[model samples]
Target: MNHFQTGRVSTNKNYFLMFLGRKGDSMIEQEIQGASVAWFKIAELIARREREKALGVCRLLAHSFPDRAYELQLEGDILWALEDTLAKDRYTQAAQLYEHNERWVEAIALYEHITTIYPIDYTALADLLFCYAMGNAYDLFTTLCNTLLHKTQTGMLSDTNYTTIMHQAQEKLQKYPTSQHTAWVNDFILWAATK
Candidate 1:
């Protein structure tokens, strides 16, 4: 059978074994092992640019093991791969996938994920900060800004550019005076300014 069919069969067998309270069933164990092998095979297909086959296998695995961390991670990896190979608009689809999975932190992280391989990633940083603020994760927001400030001090970031971005974010925060969340953002900006 194809990887997708194998995954589905394994998933059904696993559920049946669970319902029967038969934890030591060799048949079920083998099926689970088969599913894991299929999952890896799908990952290989993805790496080989077999997009349709990879997606089919990944979809089956995702449905079969909705709460499995490895499965979720693989799905995210697949989406990221598609994002790289396709247009920028593909990122929106990946973002939606994270949202559908209710992986809010991952979704936000994806929206703002960055690498220093490039000169600067101000847009990613800004989106990350905004995501933290919008989620009311004040502690995280503070920690992120503090880390960025430290990086700037260590010369990892260009001081002039960092300052300019901070100033703009602060200005934007000031415009929403009535929002407690904005107040928190303003407080963080002020604290960063003093340091």
Candidate 2:
């Protein structure tokens, strides 16, 4: 080969090797693959009251990351800020994924939002109660249980499903080792029995 051609080829090969041998390549790849940085931009757009642009980004995010609950949740939050009822639908979808994955904190937050949007949504209430028990948030569970009892007194949560949810909670508590409800679980079951 000519001298100039040989030098150019060697330089290109060195550049390629440097790119391949770069440290933290996997970390760079993870940053590129993760959604946090993009979500931050979208959040900034929302904070700036650029709802339309933020909403467009939210839709794109949901489409690109279909399996992740956080994407839909962001969309739902934007919709809520816009006072759109479709927020609930998006929140419901996200909540289902979170619940299915046993991500109790995210599911609980979404379910709480759903309940505020629909205080009489018995299914959401049941789901929230189930999450509370599973997460071992006994204080919250007991407080909500009393409120639910009052709701029943007002003929609000009078359906058979409430009783079924109670039974489900009882069954969940009955599960050994995994259940942290070692001490007060029996009392909770008794409380359900009286309901």
Number of the top candidate by TM-score? 2
Where does candidate 1 have its weakest 10-residue lDDT segment?
110-119
- Among the numbered candidates, top lDDT falls to 2
Runs in model 2 with CA error above 4 Å?
1-54, 61-67, 159-161, 164-195
Candidate 1 overall Cα lDDT vs. reference? 0.63
Report how far off residue 8 is in candidate 2 (Å): 39
The whole-model lDDT of each prediction reads 0.63, 0.73
**Model 1 regions more than 4 Å off:** 1-41, 47-76, 79-93, 96-104, 111-119, 164-178
- Give model 1's TM-score versus the native structure: 0.52
Candidate 2 scores a C-alpha RMSD against the true structure in Å of: 10.1
The sequence of per-residue lDDT tens digits that candidate 2 reaches over residues 1-195 is 753566775546445545667555565566566657668878798778787898887776676555678877888888787777888888989998998898988888999889888887766776787777777777888887778767666877774755665665556556646546534545664775676
Candidate 1 RMSD to the real structure: 9.6
